[model samples]
Target: MSASSGTTAHAPSRAPWLWIAALALLVIMTRLWMSSAVSWDQNEQLVWSQRLRLGYGPQPPLYTWLQWAVNLVLGPTTLAVGLVKNSLIALTFVFMLLAARQVLPERTAWLATAGLAWLPGIGWQLLRDQTHTVMLTCAIACTWWLVLRHIRSPRPLGFVWIGLAVAWGVLSKYSFVLVAVALLAAALTVPAPRRALLSRGFWLAPLVTVVLVSPHAWWVLEHWDKASGSTLDKLHPADTPSRLHGLATGSGDLLAFLLLAVLPWLLMATYTLGKFWKAPAAPAASADSKHTSSLPWVEPLLRHYAIVVVGALALMVLAGASKFDGRWIQPLLLMAPLWALSRWPQAGNNARGARRYLTACLTILVLMCAIAMLAPLRDAQRGNGDRLNWQLDAIAASLRNAGFDGHGVILAEHHTTGGVLHMLFPQAKVVVCDADDPGFHLGCAWRKAERARAKGLPLLQVSTETPAPDAWWWAAWPIGSMPECQIHNLPYRWTDPAQAQMQLEFIVYPADTSAPVSAPVAARPTLHASAHSHLQ
Candidate 1:
């Protein structure tokens, strides 16, 4: 039997591509309409994107480099961030579809790609609050696709592409090493993949990876504490009572992470396909059969996933790790849908079943979009708010009205506030004051802040909470005395009568006598009453 005999009819040649593009557009539009404020991860990325560097704290520099590039073109606005994030998300879907097509029939490939929307990590969390994780997922997907293609028909250039993808993945997140190691281990167990790996051109992969990653590697060596300290602290927490207890906790967390990341796709597939685990009857051998069998590649891919999970647990036990975040396993679990579909290719033979699965995926996408669009209104109704609802624009206006030009230095209590301020006043130097750990401070921003202070330029300190006179940041006050702060009670973006106003306090330090006074503000923007009608 042909591949199509074991799968649904081929979809229109361009239908899947069009759907992917349309889905991307819908997500981007929804995010643009949701709120202008950046989420937590977005804020961190914006702050780091102020300047390019070889490394950033905790995470690798690739995502920051991309963000900086986008900001260079788009001027550090929310739109710049949104576009970069959504594009990676769309690329992820494209890569997954391409990889699936290599191992399964065309229709099954589309279904596998659609099934990604059912995973909460990819579907909702990515849209709402993930940054580096999104980039890493895209890189992993690209790597998988390239590796599969290379395995099917080995080529020297194919190894080069895989090398580039691997380098990109590592630079996106350090955890990607686990995936890479697992892939190699699993590939060695299979004949075709093993022979392909032994090819002379395979040496090019590591050479390319090392050459591309050398600069960042040097930076990590020089700044080892800054690069790996926080991650180590998280993995080996001081509070762990004992190794035995730590292993138990870590294993449990790892299991929970896998389930949360993969269960949605698994449950949804089972519901739609009905007992897909059952093995399908083998097709009778025929001389005219033209379809390449997927079993060789699919089996190894599944083994690769298994090794990733088992290896993660083993590392946790070895390192005595006590905590695990579900997001960390994203790259490994990203291909779960493809693996599930590959197990029984005949699962897609039912036209009604395929349609039902596609419909369910689209429904999830719509629901996620709706949730994002309505998030601000929901926060307002509940009388609690996050960064999204903060009145950053109004706060910026109030600062300008206070005879403070956007030319000096701003010290913010949190990175979220600092990021927003940096975006609003791109000319000003913004430093986050809340990083108690000296290792966490971004050296570039700190140096700029100090230089601006020494020059007696406009210095402003802003915070949501009142700062004590003895606060660490106050030590650098140019005036040598504590300045009186003006407290503004600004309403959130969405209005709820019962909601309390957010408190924002700011202090402006005196400038040098030789410094020119700021020009009088013209057409100061006033805060407007919240209109709930627009959101509805």
Candidate 2:
């Protein structure tokens, strides 16, 4: 009772929390609005939005749903989606603070919230507006909410939050398994919460989660082989994010995620390790009930936070035995900070105590945000805002330049290039290059068929978008009688069918390009195969 009263005495300061939260929100809103003008994932997002299905060719549905919601509310713009996603990310700080407050004082909570507001990876992801990051953030918040609920009141309702958490985790991204695993570990670790499993509530969570995910599962079944292969390729990563860089990536990601949360995380991590090391004693196994003399209101929460940290992390590593990218482990980052701060030792003086721990985090967070938003600074940084697609322009120019009277068909294997071409040159008809997806190949076929209906003549395919990567085509030209082909084998397996590439070199079948030129047009400017490799 004395411990509870003492913790109540150290209740968080509303003033500083409000000030920091407001500033953090301001920064969030600014970054979000700034990102609205152009989209990094615009092409994929546009496709997903229009298609409107449970699953996509590669990505999960979270970003699409987010994009759809943003478009519905503010109407469509690249910037608007960016802002919305960023705002949602920034809002997660409230969750962090609430979670922290259960373990730390109000002041510490605010500081932690402030730190999280601009934590590098978290802030960066919010601005980027990708599905993986947002889904992970939602999953983390759900986890925190469930943990606190169980600690405060372990019941069937508490278990219901767990199920909801899993549902959102799945809907957001298939990686919700990691979040579920963390929750399971959290439920088991805390003594008060252990009863959760014995009740009907435990299995109810998984059952509800499975029911919610049935549609996506069906979608996967519909495109079984392709989906499985793509997912596998993504997990194992053909391009080498092999575990070493993966570890550094995860560590760096943690630092970034923890950057803006507060000094308490810094203090707690330092305090625990420094004390545990310098003092050199095993933390009491029964420290939860007795620790109130030293720790705060919900010391159990802190202990659970540690279990969540390690458990979620172990699950992440096991999963990453197949996948990488720091963002995928986002939920882990969020939970880790909460765990770190919750363990923060109580110092007699709150002001000096918080200042010493939180100063670096807050300072760096604000400073980096300013640097990121600075126009010149952003441009100078690699992977910052300046990157643009020259490939789109090149593809558009080739088609436009090829046409004698500016009337011809432009086809592409994907809608990305077609959409880019449409945006770049609205007058030209852009069609999907795929032979299989008729809707994709329809535009060019419709244009050519219309022309033929008016005056019968064979259509000509203007240019293929296969120049740069297929540079080895010269060696493989007349690609017949090759040893690999003779064995009915292949070299450098490309993901798509040959119909996927623009292979027609003036052949009648795929729509020939080299018909006789009209008079006054000099010899059709022949493309040197060698120059094809120079494409940037």
Q: Pick the candidate with the highest TM-score.
A: 1
Tens digit of per-residue lDDT, candidate 2, span 109-163: 5555655643445655634536556656856775676666555555777666767
Residue-level error in angstroms, candidate 1, position 17: 0.9
Separately for all candidates shown, the number of backbone clashes (residues 3 or more apart, or on different chains) is 0, 14
* lDDT by residue (tens digit), candidate 1, 346-463: 6677788898889999999999889888878888878875668877678788788766799888877677778888888988777766645442244533454456657987888776
- Reference-based lDDT, residue 189, model 2: 65
Q: Runs in model 2 with CA error above 4 Å?
A: 1-25, 32-39, 117-120, 126-129, 196-204, 225-228, 238-323, 345-349, 356-359, 375-385, 388-536
lDDT of 1 at 362: 93
Query: Clashing residue pairs in candidate 1, if any?
Result: none
What is the Cα-based TM-score of model 1? 0.89
> Please, what is the whole-model Cα lDDT of each candidate in the order they appear?
0.75, 0.48
